[model samples]
Target: MVLLERAMPTTLISMLAKIHGENPVVSEAKGVVPTCTCALMPKSGGKQGECKWCWRILVNREGLWFRVLASRYGLVGGRLKRGDRNGSVWWRDIASIRDGDASVLGSWFPENLSVHVGNGANTLFWLDRWVDDVPSCVRFSRLYDLSENKLATVAQMFSWGWKIGGEAWKWRRRMWDWEEEMVVECRSLLLTALLQVDTEDVWTWTPDPVEGYTVSVAYLTIIDRTPPTNNVLAALLWRKDVPMKVSVFAWRLFRHRLPSKTNLFRRGIIPSEAQLCISGCGQQESETHLFLSCTLFGHI
Candidate 1:
């Protein structure tokens, strides 16, 4: 053994002490927070309000919303939990499922053509390759720009048109439908990572858009609000020459809220009055009510 010259820094010694098995006690990456299952509070389950992690990142988001199962050798495994809001931090997994979860891909598809019967084996093999369900499911796979820092929004679904006879997939129904479902499923997977919305709504997990079809989520976001009455309501978006309606302008101006033009005039215009009106108390509705002091406007 060689003789040591100087004592190591206490911080360095302490960091070394944190080593458990082969993993380090402390992570070097910034903007990353560690969480324990215990800290995860169940918003739905009986564990109502208790936080699960030792410390929670104030804005701990899950990144990219893509799916990957890291499993291998019964040692490492878990799903990439909240991939939506983008907790873009380096993750040092204590355990990962490197091969176990992905085994379906290798097992489902063999090198023999008999294994890929008419439509039966082929579809199963396709899904396994793409990490999709064997049966129908809304797929949302996408390639995100990790370096650009700007996120891309992939359309959630698109219809698949395949003709089995000539060009329409060339004269087959089962194959066409199978092919179509596969195409749409692939699109779904791509879109899930691209868009951030509560898919449980009437939208999401629906049929793909038809060819040459488009839908604006922006339009869906605008809530039905009260309309505006006078030219003052139109503000800059209004003029006889402009030929614009106050209601239409109101949406562009305030991003869709309220129930009607008159409602904006009465309730959303002033803050206290709407609250007071229902309470049978005192509240005034005015331009200041409509413009300066309303929760609906979102000016702040």
Candidate 2:
């Protein structure tokens, strides 16, 4: 347990509690606030208005959104009821079946979510992302793809028996010997984790030491996904008093990553040879030749 006065944000530290299930309740920072403006309200269902942050939280199934939804729409009352704005209607609007909830959920709830399987009523057996930070279908795709009830919850699968091919054992689609073994293994894994019917399944955000989402963490997560850019010419490109659009173009030019005809040709997007410069120079156009050696261009 490495204690620190200031919090450090790293995917590694976040994965610690997730992979091992060592839940340490750290004291939240003083005067901490929810990343969402919805938290400011004494009570909320997001019916009247939801800020960008709250809407994102609801979409990701994180923070108050997850809690409210998991509580069977009883957590937050009023206009944001089951079929209302912040309920199933909101979910359907953003995460349609055609678009696939997995894609939408995946954008926010990456591998850092530690799903505490409780009653298993809401925790999907194969699809809802209950176990191992990934969907059971993804981990055991062979069995899941063949199984008839793809959206069945953990409770339903365990209680009524997993309806492979949507029928009882006598008339259900036959499973290969290996698939049977895999099914047994899958069942064993779920059964091993004692599900407390009294408790509801919870989705936790793991990036913060206190298990709360922060804008900083979210920002860093996005940066981590993007390829890093060189800062060598940043000072030159982002000069004081320069307009934003001009600075952006300057930055692109500095990096030689602009979608110019020559660059596009080099990237195989253009069929024309790289010899004819846009300025009509006879020499083969290159980043160095364009700005520095071209006979037509004035030196900066």
Candidate 3:
């Protein structure tokens, strides 16, 4: 049998242990806490100009795996572009997760992931949460809708100039007096925003900024956000005494992922008429019917 069923429980437990083992004090006092720089300092790349004092140097960039995805799917401002209909299965799945299509963790990534604007070259002007807690597109929906170039990056817009009569204010048509006031308000907000010409924009994971992103922490966060019923079901699904295949079967049954006739019909693997229960109960062979409501197997 496959190791999928047996490994899940052990993996979950290990992840939980790792999450619990992290020091609460260290995590909370991350940027404020001072540390000894005696032996841990870099040997070769000591201090370079203003980089030594800049916190952007500590921000982690995307890894090889993410870079590979970006290369295949296309990248916009150091982030993966939205996947199209012609994209591969893996890419589409990833895109769905990024777009908050996942039922369990809706909008988690977008809510937690924020950009620390530096040169502004690698941050979206309207979509990224750099200026405020929410994206500019959301905060100024009316202005965003009127904009001619909705896809402009922060640097691009800044270069064009963001002042009232600047070239960056390219709208579809003339704005009303109220809209002009809104633009003034928007410009006023950006007045204090200073862009560092040398530093590149950095993406930060809000949950654990110090250690950055980790699979264990992400998994734990997802589990914590899941509904109590789902958590309870998952806990009950992987029992130490249960056989691997049996556990797998139960999991599939519960998830409606088993190859039932109704599911097969839905996937176009079987004809609609052929989706009747094999037990001849004149009902669709769905997980609920086959496992719990079937007169033959259900009672057995």
lDDT of 3 at 287: 75
TM-score versus the correct structure, for each prediction: 0.19, 0.43, 0.54
Q: C-alpha displacement of 16 in model 1, angstroms?
A: 7.4
- Rank list by TM-score: 3, 2, 1
lDDT by residue for model 3 (1-300), tens: 115323434234334335556221121212111121111222221111112112222243332223334444555654566567865544454455555554434566667678788999878888778999998888999999999868888898999999867889999999999999989989998998899999998777777778766544454465467543766566546756557787788678657799989889989998889999999999998876765578997666
The ten-residue window of minimal lDDT in model 2 covers: 44-53
Q: How would the candidate models be sorted by lDDT, starting from the highest?
A: 3, 2, 1
Model 1 TM-score, all chains together: 0.19
Clashes of 2: 0
Could you give candidate 1's per-residue lDDT for residues 82-120 as a string of tens digits? 222232212211111111121111221111011112212
- Model 1's number of clashes is 52
Candidate 2 lDDT over 1-300, as tens digits, reads 113212423333335445555442231322222223222223322211222233344335434334323333332211122345554434443333212333222344334455577887756677656756577778888877787666666776667754354231221477789888887677666555677889876655566537455444543453465443555245434655567888887667656787766788878887876547767868767665665567876244
Off-target runs (Cα >4 Å) in candidate 2 are 1-93, 96-110, 162-172, 209-211, 226-300
Candidate No. with top TM-score: 3
Model 3, runs deviating above 4 Å: 1-67, 101-104, 223-300
lDDT of 1 at 47: 10
